[model samples]
Target: MDELKIPNVVCKIEVYAAVNPSEDPDKVRLAVSHVILETDYQYKEGSIKATSNQLNSLVKIQETIKKHRTNKIYRRQMRFNTKGDTTWFYLNKQAAFVDVIAACEEAEESAMGPIKVILHSKDLDKVVDWLAPEMTE
Candidate 1:
């Protein structure tokens, strides 16, 4: 198997998830933690937020895409959402809570709510390539 290469690009990743009144903040926090491992988070009324500057922070996402064979899906979404130096995508919060990285094509796809992930980098194309490279059959 070919080894996955981590991009050398410098970037900032910001993740956000809203806590519905009926939802537990702790569970929401868990979902975020499972997705973006080992990062300090900020709790606000009805929301959870975290940020990281390291590419390794995306290791979970990279591994999940490879494991689930969803690289094409992610690549398409990331490219579609790209805006200049930044791009954003949504993940199913419920799947995240279970430590599964499931991407949401739309916010409504995630029943409870979706975790919004925003990525900013000088070379976003390179970042996207690293995260979801074209895989061969």
Candidate 2:
């Protein structure tokens, strides 16, 4: 698989279980959960989920929270794109985030369609905010 450099200031990423109907109409949907952020700081090990929309917003949010690191140092919850057909996870470490993104990119390049990531983030509050509404059963 080819490794691509992560664009600096990515701040947040939202992975979606994307389905290419042209490649395989029968396999039109998959859960692409695992969006994350890349920070210079360290965090506990865990998991969380989020949406592409929320993930995209973090780039701006990061600017706001950059000076308030102490208050913003945890993972956020998972959310579905308002489109709601896909899922995502957010992260803060490039090394850890790369493994999954690389694999997915490879799969797509090789025409393997969509895939899912099951890892969680280290920040509990963020996880709760993302998953709470759906997990309330």
Candidate 3:
């Protein structure tokens, strides 16, 4: 696979996960970390929130989408969830824990709850294209 070009845009990316009584906080943090690079994590009442203002944070997700040939799925999710300058998607928590980036169409798809990733940007279309381009054979 060739190198992916990270979009140059001012955006705020946040990954959130609810920490259930049966789940370990550290494991939740690890899951979020695997998805977003160098995330600044914040722990609150039964929840974990991580934030990043750089497009580089999405590099791993971009690579995973290409590697798994899931670009259309991610692009659809992102566009479908778009509202104003923000769009969000869900990821399977268990898949993320093991360093696999999996996009979920709904939160209930993941047995242990899903990781919610939100993106806010004025240039949302550019960001989405960079993250998951329309692949052509």
- By lDDT, who's the top model here? 3
Off by more than 4 A, model 2? 1-10, 22-30, 34-108, 114-137
Expressed as tens digits, the lDDT of each residue in 1-137 for candidate 2 is 12222223212333333333333322222112222333222111221233332333333333333333322222222333122232333322222223232222233343433333322334423432333222211
Which residue pairs overlap in candidate 1's backbone?
none
| Superposed Cα deviation of residue 52, candidate 2 (Å) | 6.0
Model 2 lDDT-worst window of ten: 39-48
> Model 1, 1-137: lDDT tens per residue?
77688878899999999999989999999999999977879999789999999878989998898888899889989989988999989999999999889999999999998999899999898888888888887
Per-prediction count of colliding residue pairs? Answer: 0, 22, 0
- Go through the candidates in order and give the C-alpha RMSD of each one to the true structure: 1.0, 16.0, 1.0
lDDT of 3 by residue, 20-133 (tens): 999999999999999999779999999999999999988899889888889999999998999999999999999999998999998999989999999999999999988889
Better of 1 and 2 by lDDT: 1
Off by over 4 Å in 1: none
Ranking by TM-score: 3, 1, 2
- Write down the TM-score for model 2: 0.20
lDDT to native, each model:
0.91, 0.30, 0.92
